[model samples]
Target: MHAISVRRVRRSLPRAALALVLAALGAALGPGAAPAAAAGHAEECSTEAGPYQKTVERHLKLTVDGVQSAADCAAIRTLQTRHGMEPATGRAGPETWRIVQYERAVADPSALTGCPHGTRLIVCVDLHRQLLWVWDGDHVATGPVPIRTGKSGYATRTGEHRIYERVEKQWSELYEGPMPFSQFFDGGQALHASYRNIWEEPGSHGCVNLRYDDAKRLWQGLRLNDPVYVWGTRGP
Candidate 1:
């Protein structure tokens, strides 16, 4: 789910070949990836098409998921990670292609990677907001998605922390893989994505589980060793 899209794709043979493949794939996703399907269930009818408050579904699909390109996707695996998504076989499932289609409607491959190197964009994952806000100077880009922080014995840490390293794709979580991205902090305390939301609510192993799209976008937008400040709504 790197921001580098086919649009930004160069005329290189590798990119061209991928585009040809993707055209077939994108076409297969047409009924779903088409503009009309922008919001999953009737976009124009949605009042909250309220700008970004709108979404069709989630995750992208690639017909040749594990083809091993020299591209960034070289990091991804073939199997569909548990609750996360795999590149759909082009059938356009509601969970994967369906969600990404809408992203296409609003996405600009060039615009997403605007954060310059060394510029610190403040990102605050407000548990209370149920929305993650990326603050670029005073500009805020927000998105709404499900997240699970912690349950009982494991509570999400509060206070300021700097992201030292980031993992684009992980393999340890076992089920859906260890999440595609982990802005690692102490040990396992990372801002990641998870499946067991315990009814789509806040529930995690002390890790902040952001929605997949949120994680993907944040992963691309954020640079190595970025700053993430997490504050809890619930007081100690």
Candidate 2:
């Protein structure tokens, strides 16, 4: 395993202020409590037909007309924006459709399909689908959230592993960046929050990158020694 260094766009907050914010968050919430989502303005809805326009329309229970109408765009855009998809375009794109699939699957336990479920917490990473979900035996403690895994040749390793370390805030000396809510399960590769948009192309070095809120919640929901199961090749 190699040291995983993530390239990200730094936020505006100063380092000290960011630290204080995180400290305040820890004090305000008990362990395993979910964090409230950060406030944001809704993205503009897309009017152009997405590549998978029909797929999105059918799933959103709209007329399967393959055309991107105002209503279709609004529904699709809302779903995309809520899931933190980049662009938040109402047009049905590959990433948008993938998120739709995950959302549908998350509602149905059987849709989880793989990654053994038992009494212990098991983190399941579906590289092909670009999603991660935490399974507490039969219960899903957290996740089924969107994620960006290693890109190109630096694919995230697949197999059974266990989290060995966790750091609420970890600094990467090699890359000179922050890896927040880092749960190191394999060598330097961990499940952590990426400062960059997880939907952006060309993914991480080898870590499983989640949204900030998702990673923070994962930190609270998971503990050391929790099993992690990763499988499937990332789709093109």
Best by TM-score: 2
Candidate 1 minimal-lDDT segment of 10 residues: 1-10
Residues 26-103 of candidate 2: C-alpha lDDT, one tens digit per residue: 567866552443224345677789888988788889999899888998899888878766667687887877877778
On the 0 to 100 scale, the lDDT of residue 178 in model 1 is 54
- lDDT score of residue 179 within candidate 1: 60
Total clashing pairs for each candidate: 5, 1
Assess the local accuracy of residue 86 in candidate 1 as a C-alpha lDDT between 0 and 100. 32
Tell me the deviation in Å of residue 223 in model 1: 1.6
What TM-scores do the predictions have? 0.44, 0.76
lDDT of 2 at 196: 79
Q: Identify the runs in model 1 with alpha carbons over 4 angstroms from their true place.
A: 1-120, 142-145, 173-177, 195-202, 234-236
Which portions of model 2 show Cα errors greater than 4 Å? 10-48
Error of 2 at 123 (Å): 0.9
Q: What are the lDDT figures for the candidates, one per model? A: 0.45, 0.80
